[model samples]
Target chain A: MFECLFEQASLLKKICEAIKELTDQACFEVSGTGISLQAMDSSHVSLVSFLLRNEHFSQFRCDRNLTLGLNLKMITKILKTAGNEDRVTLRAEDDGDHLVMVIESKTGNKISSYEVKMLDIDQQAFGVNETDYKASTKMSSEEFQRICHDLLVVGDTVSIEMTKDGITFSVSGTETSGCITCRQSGTVDDESVGTEITLQEPMNLSFALKFLNLFTKATPLSNSVSIEMSADQPLCIHYDIGDMGNIRYFLAPKIDDEEGAGAAGAPAAAPTEAAGGDDE
Target chain B: MGIKHLMQVILENAPDAVVENPVPSYFGRVIGIDASMALYQFLIAVRVEGQQLTNDKGEVTSHLMGMFTRTTKMMAAGLRPVYVFDGRPPEAKQNELARRHEVREDAKEKEAEAKEAGDQAEMERFSRRQVRVNQQHCDEAKRLLTLMGIPYIEAPGEAEAQCAALCRAGKIWATGSEDMDSLCFGSPILLRNLTFSEARKLPIREVHLDQVIAGLGLTMPQFVDFCILCGCDYCGTIKGIGEKNALKLIKRWGTIEQALEHLDKTKFPLPESFNYQQARALFQQPEVLDPARVDLRWGQPDEEGLVQFLVGEKQFAEDRVRATTARLRASKQTATQSRLEQFMGPPAIMTSCSAPPGPWPMVQGPIVLTPSPFPPLRQQAGAAAAEKGNKKARTSAKGAKGAAKATATKPAAKKR
Candidate 1:
């Protein structure tokens, strides 16, 4: 009645690390097909959308489809206490309200279990439309995470400009502005340029670096992650969830001072000109 | 008797009545004292203790000691103390913070000037008599409040005003303050003499909004007039007129305009334009103190964990902490037990058996999660095929080539 197994515990730990940045609490909606979680941080700057399909788990069993709202910090604590070689097993006892997470080490050591409360969260479905993004590119998760971390030192906000050639991550402060661009000419060794879609419309969106860093922490789960951006719209980052499913994050762009004041004096910088330029 | 002796005689005779006479039940419960201000008073009291108040190290130590004592006493009282810390003040209060800052700066300058002038006595006096509250101390107070399990609200502006709002709204029974402005701000109950004695012994003066207006011999509008004439927050008042004169003027005239008409324009002058209406609105408009809706659940206390954190980590005195914790534990047993019971319930059964172990582990089996399962992409593709039926046929040929690459890479990528 209380035994379930997973090949690796590290994957869950990585996932927890990713979402822990966005929000302190999230509801994991598990159904017959897969598990999905959609939650926005308190600031509404970022949202963590995670999906793990049924095929990912080696032996998944359930009496019914259930939703467990978990505290991110508690889950991260349990995961941190676990060894990497340990096989993850989660079990339910005492009427599905409590969770026991066990990690069995390779040396035949007794599995250590941590009992956590499954809180009843007020789940409200947010109506978010799936928009057709202007451009999409895949880059290494490590690179993305590193870029976000470095950019945070400069400022709290980052402006992401994507075009036909590649992606440009820019941050501007009162004194200085920094930009990192990956174009067709200067392609990194491990990175892949799938397809270049021309920017019929150039969009410059600002987002909080804190949320970006948190959501990108899921990068270790996949070698490469895909990013899709549309001007004046939410940026969607897709993480390939091995054979299980995919985790897609939709982040609402911050309203910068220029764009918010009715676009009157804001420069219409040709997104094509800055598409692959190193100049900030 | 001499003035000091007469003051002592009066203090002995009165001894400050601890509990005021009980009034109507409409007055709210559990008054909130501005903890930061209370801490300031406690620190001053400590400085006054044992005739030794001149040392900087002594001042800091005394403040810290007072903090612990106040925390312990508040915990033993059984009153849910909601301490409110001031955040960024509103633009209106910028002047106040700046004014205080300027005064502190001037005091520092004066101390320096006195030192340079070889006025050692004045310099020592100024150093010892410094009354400025430090941000570090305020932060420490907040840390202490958190440890003590006293719920605190970070006020966007003035702590006293927020406390007053809380009182008027019936969120709290009264505001524990020496400042009479709370009454002007329409706080239903204002408890004085809290510092002088224990809460049980202290008299809480429950001042009703209607009674205040009636007792002051003015309508709600004219009562605000009396306060403004007696010096409201927004601006300075007439120099000569005291509270008694302002009250008499307001009662006779029935309005500030009427009072102004009777005043000597040259000596008892008024500002160019008085915003008495806004002031009236602030003081007269009763705050919605929705008591029933406040989430009072303090959650389960990890007593052992708290003990380990405070005593072991922070190096707080064990016996003193143990005593305070014992009292808190006794009072909080029911809530804590219920929370613990809830947390110890049944576990979660993983739904997807065949799902790969990843971030979003899916449930095994051929299950279509979405109700309309042409799949969103398939539906869009079908619609695109229908719309660009002819032109996309050639594009589809190129798409097939891309699809071939995707198919080839999918399996190998999954292996890693």
Candidate 2:
């Protein structure tokens, strides 16, 4: 009864690719508004969620809201079958068990379909909203990916500090320490290349670089990425999927270890305490 | 058949008859088990996510598994368990047994219908409703008990009656079962919820008969008649008369005969074959082995025999069996405890402790299985008939495979 058509198969592949590192399976909430997914990793450390709004699809039809527990890997495998340009349509009956997916070639000459078995996952998906962040910054997706990737060799965690001037990415390992600071651009022709920093108060936060590196999987889908942070709160990494919707990743900030945090934050929930207990 | 709503009625009327927390009181004491009842409970419980546990021969071994692990855990916690087996049903109880058989038959049909509809919830409910402790089931338990050196007696008539008599003779401290009718047979200490794992936090509810008699303000004979008025496994009661109403009638008339004679039969029709007299006699003078001559003892468990029977034959995980034997070895300190300690050191390995709230495969029962995630596909209820039938959908199978349901004194049976 509910179905959503994505013009390109590549979007789903990228989304699944982005989330695979965070969780194996995710509950896809399909409704009249759009198809959205929110799931925490088994370790409950980081969480990833995506909302694909209705306007994004060429043809969208939904009779009722349906929650589908899908294996991300299986979806990735299914998506791999279609070419990047293929128009993929996901449909499921109201009370039916399988989520039927139909992929049609851009030329409309060839078509393929698959029925993915759904699982009865009982855990509730946590909701995230736009909170009053201490600091927010936007930069080129390539810049963000490079900064995350470049910082990896230097240290395990990158301590990020944002102020009135711009955002600073700092990493201090046992033997070496490095810092990459991006100054706010005065004016730009394109938003992708333009760097913007909005700050209520200067905030310094630390996060595991590996999780940030994983979030860069969505880099190919968008030209720009946004970073939002608050004191003792989880850092929000976002990639807006061309005005249709967005994919957001939340990583708990490193606690106790300020500059050179040894291991990955121990999957702390210090920031998630305000975000509600649902995320954990 | 367990004196429908008798436990609840007693608790409601005379709360003093019930002991709230009796767990600490059971240490180092011999508790008599209604063997058939315990087996029924075990078979219903040991399910791995709603599927029955079975051996390669297609023989269901949930009872054996439950008995072995539970008995070992009981011994580890310093409890002397005496399992009393059911021998034969008395003549007066035939009608009640037949009625139970019919109910099971009906449940079997309902289970099939539920399966056909893919209603996992209803299917699991119906499956638990169809718990049958046949002679073969009893034999399997006896084999395991023998391997573990747990002493068990074959009662002449009813296991409940024998347990009550044994308790009265001071051979056992209390009769352990979920049946409220254990009180009907005049068990001085009828302890319920012993069939489930102790880790469940279900405070063992102990019923004292003397306290009940004193609480109800009735003599022993009057109490027996009151129990019959409530209903027992021996006979049917007048329809439309529930436990509380029955209690009021018993208190008013003092006996079922007087109540039957005095009440109008139009509103509450008496059953045609209502034989309250024979039931009264059966409850008063139950056929049981003389507790004086009974040899209640805990002997050494044959380690090789247990491993051979449970692991080799029954497909139980070998390490678990060895682990349990190790615990049994560590537990002996007294004449019993020394033999226990003389055998091995401390490695308390009763998987039921870590076993998730098991067996009551209600909606979404998930327990972390140690040996394997899922056992080989379980045999169907009617295995021979349904062997070739496409495997039933277990897609919505698991959540917490633990015995969380404490079968308390609920009166759901009165509707039908």
Candidate 3:
């Protein structure tokens, strides 16, 4: 048997909403350590993995490890029905066919329960070990979301270049071209509230802008987002969910086709030095 | 034709067995369509007065019109539909075919009577009932599918059974048809209200076989017996037993043999020639094309080829054909950006092979679902074999370019 409770419904609601943008169904690996999920999108171009520690929940209990395969869309829809102030508890048996969810109003005057069938989603976890990234940038979540959203209109991809000066994001289309460069600034607070940048061995990579926009769906869950890029591994987008835990999205770089190769070189046009300040 | 009232019975008994999706919800999905059933519906529905739509040569074009519009519309909406046409009828199905032949003969007589009486509406209704999907229609559909750059499979027996087998094999996400037999044949997912969506305002209903089995409190074998008892197209049903009684009896007795022993033969007599056992066996294991041998790819719709076939050969309106072909080509440019939407909207997009493949190990589930993610990248279990061919051929540019690609790809391959 396994059960866990969130003090409030909105946190659970946001997490579900954010992850549903990545996958329709996923395995929530529940263990005594905490609840973690590791799943890639259908294309295998990007993966979303996260762990919400056991201490974060109001009440958490599990006798044995359980892999709860669930339809994230269905879970999101069910969570939408709950009042934001309501307390939500999820309970499931080891060999049972469904997950039982109980939602109670903060006043305790009303309570509703839902039973969603479990899916047999056998997902193979791609071990995503933390890397000594060539470049890591922390920026305001809203700012990153804007850059991704706006650049998509110019082209399908964004060429990101991190140099000794700063981190530059630029795109070049057949008819239009645009660029935004973010420079190192105020300490990216350990609490993860401020903008900052750290570059070691400058790197440049082209990534699908649409995926970047999708990773920003987690913006509501946190005020800031950190991007880690390495030549050998998938780029990681991290969103710390307050003090509880953090969710990271790993996107594979676009293996440059002829067009992408041109765009990757065009980013050199962005302003050099990119003086200190938030683009937002 | 499907088992009578089986859908209704499932709807009533299994509370949450089927999930209702908004029309046009599936994007980048590969669904298997029972071809003949769709064409038959088109013959019956797309009509002007009592006459079938035809070309200048007086050859019927109703099925072609339906196939072009439906397939292109599905493609434009990001659904990769693979048509499955029936081949030879099975021995057990001979009885059902004979019954249908008799019905069509009666309809032809009624249609003649209506024509003689100058009753246009009655004549149309009777004529529609007499419609049949022959080898000509099947050939035309396969030809049109080829022209549109879609894959089609020729089943050895029933299309519904073949579709169910394909779904079970994870070749497609679901078996799409108006037939409930796909459920009895054990398709993991059956999608209804798929075709003629503009007219069908109701949401698409997806029936999960596993969910139905669990909800009905019956094992798969028990479900097959229940379906046979409920009345299958392959055999005669019990005289007084219908869907309701069959469900209750199956739930009570657990098997058809046991139900026959407990049933009152005096009040509820048996059919003239009954063979529940044989019908159950047919439903349990029907012949189908081996899923592994089937190569599914959503190639960019051959635009020029499509125009030549539809406009130059078939006498389709040039402008309409051109406009629809434009829609098909447009989907190629924006055919799923290979990242986020696959998990959100649809699970897969069969390798379209235009963009460079990503650097990731083809980590597979036990059953790899086709329409299997990434439009341009060759990223599926079947495509992995195809990729292996390219890996061996070393297709990169010669000299420095080839060497660079090898060095770039080697680490990724080793990491996986």
Candidate 4:
């Protein structure tokens, strides 16, 4: 049995907020350590991994470690229905196929239990290897988040480039493609920051800005956000979740025009959306 | 202008004129002007005669007159100005610049088209009212700075940031600009009123760079975060978040990271990967060091040349120009005499300008000054002269390649 209560229901809102970026469905494995979910986003550009440590829970009980696969949309709906004073309980039923989530309050009580189904998702076995990246920057989560919001109007894909001088965030497209770029020249104040990590390799990578925009939602949890990447390697974005735990999102670089489809190792339609979404 | 008259003019020409607090001192230093937004204010304040000024060749001279007058006034105030001539903008900003360029180009094109279409009246109106700063105007400003003995630094990228850096390094006291971004770049002073009379009347306000962050209830890092949130040249800020909301959110969250986390979970609309930290670092970084240093000195004034340029060429009122020149010459004389006394002092021989002397006896005269009070000048003068002659030899001896040879012989010479 796992139960948590907050005067404000927004705490649970954040947990679901991060998951929605990675995949529509998530399988959370609850153990003595707490709840953990690891999955790649739909575009496969990034992997989202989350862990809520046992110590952060108000009340935690687990007889054995159990993996529960649940749909993100369903969980979001349940969280949306939750009232500020409602007590939320999440428990795995005796029956292996079901999980029970109950929200109770003076107004009424709502009990919802979802059937667990094993999804045959073809997981890519990508190794995480460290590389020498030219520059690393720490930004306020709010600022980073704001950039992502702006990108929604600019384009779906954003490119990040890091040189010896500084890091740049840009987007480009043809008559069919538009781009935005942000560059920081190496200056004195940035050099004095002990937290910066810079190597010798200039890196350029493109990824769907939408995922980044959603991934940055976790920024409010910490003051500093760290980004690590290499020229042809996957970019790693790490968020500090305080005592609760950390959430890491790793994104694979998109293929360039010259490299063609061979680099991606899979043939698929290029991701482009019609301009129908609300500006906000 | 009287308030009633000003209000009437504003009501009639509201679209053409804008009024705001005078530019701050730090921003003024960056734009290389003592008066913040002075040129723009001047353009708005003075009413131009409908009759156009013409050269001997009968070419329109209004633009040149306006540019030259504004640039000369800026130079006399000791502001170093770099006039940026517009070029083909980078692809990213091209859309925005092109949009503006189109408006100007369209007016020109429309006038020509109107004349072709036999609408002579429309063509005449467009020709009469058009105002612009062209490449020729930029070149003229540069030439004027060169002749006036004021330094002009050409910008490789954004002219405003380069100008701000000049002020930041104390190369200049302030920048004169109409844009508010100078505040974001941490300029120490800005001045808004630029005309000769207005500038003299209004005292320039010095903006403590750090105070902006403090006033906004943020740290230096958070301030950068706040600016990024407010929107920047490189990127646009989130919707529904203006300057006030941006500051409030940053203050509440303390840092960009915390803000992102809170935003991520909260029902409040938030953008992903906002990276406020990165954006802050970009604008808040310290200004680059200037390779060329400032050497403040006192020298003879070219009174005849200055008088000819200001009175004969520019047609300025002679008395006003003479009064300003007199003040400049007096200040220059006081500075020179003080330096001469320092040169006579013994301590001055040992110390470079980097290390200034401690408090010395104040010399009270028509002009208050500090005398060079060093006592060892006569004794050290001869040795210092000889040392100066062998300066190159001494430096070569201390070179890295010579270190091994010197160290190798030390012990052998000791044993002997």
Query: Model 3 Cα displacement at B396 (Å)?
Result: 62
Q: For candidate 1, write residues B1-416 as lDDT tens digits.
A: 00112112213332332235422111212556666676666555655433323333333544445655554454444344565555444443344456667776777888898989988777766654465557666665555554544455555455667677777566776777665666666666666555443434644444455555654445656656677677655544576777667767878888877887889989876665456565555556533233344432222234564466456645557786677666654433211101101211211213221222222222223222323321322233333334433231322222322222221111110110
Which of the numbered candidates is closest to the native, going by highest TM-score? Answer: 3
- Top-lDDT structure, candidate number: 3
In Å, residue B227's CA in model 2 sits off its true spot by: 1.1
Give lDDT tens digits, candidate 4, residues B1-416.
00112223222323222323332221222245422133333333333453455445554444334444544444344333444222232333443455556776778988898889988678766654344445544444434333333344444344445456667666655555544556566666544344434534654433444544544446666666666676654444566776666667788987667776776444456555444454455466523324144221212334565566545655546786566555543322211101111111111111111122222111223121122121112112223324444232222212222221121111110000
User: In candidate 2, what are the lDDT values of residues B1-416, reduced to their tens digit?
Assistant: 58777777788778968876546445556899989988998899889889789999999999988898888878776677888888778998788788889999999999999999999999999999898998888877777776676778788788899899989888898999888778878889988887796668787788899888888878888888888877778878778887777778878988887888889999888888888888888988989878877765455677888888889989999999999987864443321111111111111111111112222112121222222211111111112113323122121111101111111111111110
Comparison by lDDT, 2 against 4, better one: 2
Candidate 2 docking category? incorrect
- Give the candidate order by descending TM-score: 3, 2, 1, 4
| TM per candidate | 0.42, 0.48, 0.64, 0.35
Chain B TM, per prediction: 0.59, 0.78, 0.80, 0.51
* lDDT of candidate model 3 versus the reference: 0.72
Candidate 4 residue spans exceeding 4 A from truth: A1-280, B1-31, B34-47, B50-96, B102-131, B195-205, B255-416
Q: Of models 1 and 4, which has the larger lDDT? A: 1
Model 2 lDDT, residue A49, Cα = 72
If you assessed candidate 3 against the hidden native complex, which CAPRI class would it receive? incorrect
Model 4 chain A lDDT-worst window of ten: A271-280
